[model samples]
Target: MRGEAGLPPVDMSVKVGPLALPSPVLVGSGTFGFGEEYAPYCDLARLGAIVTKAVTLRPREGNPGPRIWETAAGMLNAIGLQNPGLERFLAEKLPPLVAAGHVVIVNIAGHDVEEYVKLAGALDAAKGVAAIEVNVSCPNVSRGGIEFGRDPAVLGELVRAVRGATRLPLIVKLSPNVSDIVPLAAAAMEAGADALSLINTLLGMAIDARQRRPRLANVTGGLSGPAIKPVALRMVWQVWQALRPPIIGMGGIMTGEDAAEFMLAGAAAVAVGTANFVDPTSASRVAAELEDFCRGQRINHVSELTGGLQV
Candidate 1:
């Protein structure tokens, strides 16, 4: 299809394992809520997919007051995976997005391996779930609260179990707090992950100088935004070089150029996270901007940007 001004349309469709997306710009989980929340701001159909917020087996109230703190170029959050639980998600949340004909990739977190398996199994049976993004950033209750993604062995086991439970395309969301991310990425892929989500939030903290207290009630929270873009890009490059698996890159992506940077670093697709809070229409805007970038570079396919970086 051609766009306005007699410009040829850039083919934006991308594949994340078995799931195919209309665009490479997806709204990251937790930031976009469910797809309907942003209906008034942008066209949902323009997005690659809507990754729903992390859903648990039961309802959660999330973190206490002071859950958010703005930093120099990013923000910290300890929302604690607040959600209305699995049953409600299937019965209520999933239906609307599917009914609207939006591609839905559900982000799920569990305290244990069994919980992960159960959640995956349930989603496998549900209609309209294009994929499952395993949020291994959540603490593993069975392992002294150490994040599942922090330990390669544990993450592998978890992914293996989830893989067995569902036939859906599986994407593991890796944590950036690790000493090296390549091992974790390898583990996920070896365990049957179709794709990897590079760099979840980095661990960070803030303090109230005068009061001598921590800024967030949780004492530490996940840091995200422009400040982490370089780190995220580096990680994506390292993992892409090491494993070459499809990566859904995210972290401080505020513009199309930012998304392009990730693509060059080896991300098959990009997700808009912290930027969503800044502009509800950020994902769609990024998609348009990426197409514009392709046109300027005389690139016919958006996929051509992936791993196009020059040493």
Candidate 2:
């Protein structure tokens, strides 16, 4: 029951490039802002790592009026990557959490490739940023998002540009909006991504039948939570087969069993995003259950379960 340093041994310790972790139950970026908003409920140290909200090149007011509209299984978000920008996030937001003792993964976005490089270089030298996750899937953004992600060449170029800018490990957050995931993942890995996180969200909408109008201000919002699970799992398996990089499987994970399914599908690690919106302590609880299941299955290490499935 005891591990190194006499700590309680767990089965979910995973890896991201050179950084090995104590668990694979991290909360997703964008949903969790700067790693402090949900602190009242869960211990930050219990997660494999914390991916902060998406910070942009400049502060954005985001979309007008209503940004989130509840759907049957998941919520549609048109938050538009509203953030404090890199300067504010590093100076004001990340410092305090850096001292709080957790691996910090900063999710970042920009309007252009140059902006991405600039932000990447700044975060690479940042005191607390353990890694940078490129948010290529934010649909509401004007540039450096879907335009780049929709095409393999553009996505590769954007990732390579950011990779050249920073010494820190890069985790490219891939979009499910693309047609073929194989070409996309292959492009990212070839362009110098240390790891990849799938997926951002599937494009969806909501309609108020009584009013005969669209619900979200943007009309269309990225669909996250449980609704996108099946597609996300398929992409994870495809990308794992194509490139074989460290894959962070996410999208619609709500239970410990769901997290286990991601690992079985070839995810090196799993992230809980929209599920956090549903259950405040979902990440920690999932971690505990994952460990317990590992013990029951007689699996000594969680890493042994990665890609356990053939198809």
Candidate 3:
């Protein structure tokens, strides 16, 4: 038991190929700021990793106003991958976050494969980027968005190019909006991916019948939070069984039980996304509950439960 630190004795250290995480509760890419915004609400070091909001080659002003839509069990957002781009991130945002002890990861988006490679190379040299989460899967925005993630060929080539660019471990986030995940997962592995993170938010929308307008100004946004948990779980289980690489799973996980189910299904770690926006303490609570679960189950290390299900 790690005493006085609110950590349990389960020893939840996880390794993604060569990268390591302290716990299984990682804050999701788009929802969590560059490991800074959540600082006031959380002990950033307590997380498995902190994935910054999706960063692009050039700074983004993000989508037009009214980008969020609230629903019964979740939220839909088309934040449009708002970021300060690589140069500004390195110069202005990254240093303090990492120095504060958060395990830093740069989540990168690109308009093309070459852009990904360039950003990867840049982050590889930037101070304190522990890893790179390739977001070739976001579907909310237009342009070279979900196209790269849906096709196995494009996915493979893009991953290979970025893999070639950085010395840091690669975690390619996969979109669930695909016909089949196996081929794409296979393509990523063959392209030198060190790890795989699955189930970027599914495409969804809400409408105001009276006003005859979409709730979100973007019309369609990526769905996340409680409502998508089942879909996320099924995809994580399928990809975990199909692909041999270590997996980081996420979708609608808001509770410790939700997080634990993903772990049982084969996720090496779970990212708590939409819940962060709903309940700032959601991630921390899940982490606590997971530790309690391991204790009750008599498991010493959380890694022992990784893909532990028997076929």
- Candidate 3: C-alpha RMSD after superposition: 2.1
- Mind giving the per-residue lDDT tens digits that candidate 3 earns over 1-311? 34434544788788877888898899898887876677678766668888888888899888896888887688788888888887898888888887787788788998988889899999998878899999978887786468889999989999989988999999999998988888998999899998888889888889999999998889999888888888888888888888757889898888887888888889899898988887787777778888778877878898887788776
The deviation in Å at residue 218 for candidate 2 is: 0.7
Best by lDDT: 1
lDDT of 1: 0.89
Ranked by lDDT, top first: 1, 2, 3
| Cand. 2 Cα-lDDT | 0.85
C-alpha local distance difference test of each model: 0.89, 0.85, 0.85
- How does residue 38 of candidate 1 score in lDDT? 89
Candidate 1's displacement at residue 58, Å, is 1.1
How well is each residue in 8-113 modelled by candidate 2, as lDDT tens digits? 4655678866667779888898877877778988767789999998888888878885789888788898888888888898889989888988888888888889
lDDT per residue as tens, model 1, 1-311: 43867778889998876778899999888999987788999778789999999988887778787889999999998888889999999999999999999889999988789888899999999999999999987431232123788889988999999999999999999889889999999999999999999878888999999999999988888899999999999999999998889999999999999999999999999999999899988999999899889888888899998989999
Once fitted onto the true fold, the runs of candidate 2 whose alpha carbons sit more than 4 angstroms away are 1-8
Clashes of each: 1, 0, 1
Supply candidate 2's per-residue lDDT for 169: 82
Stretches > 4 Å off in candidate 1:
1-4, 139-146
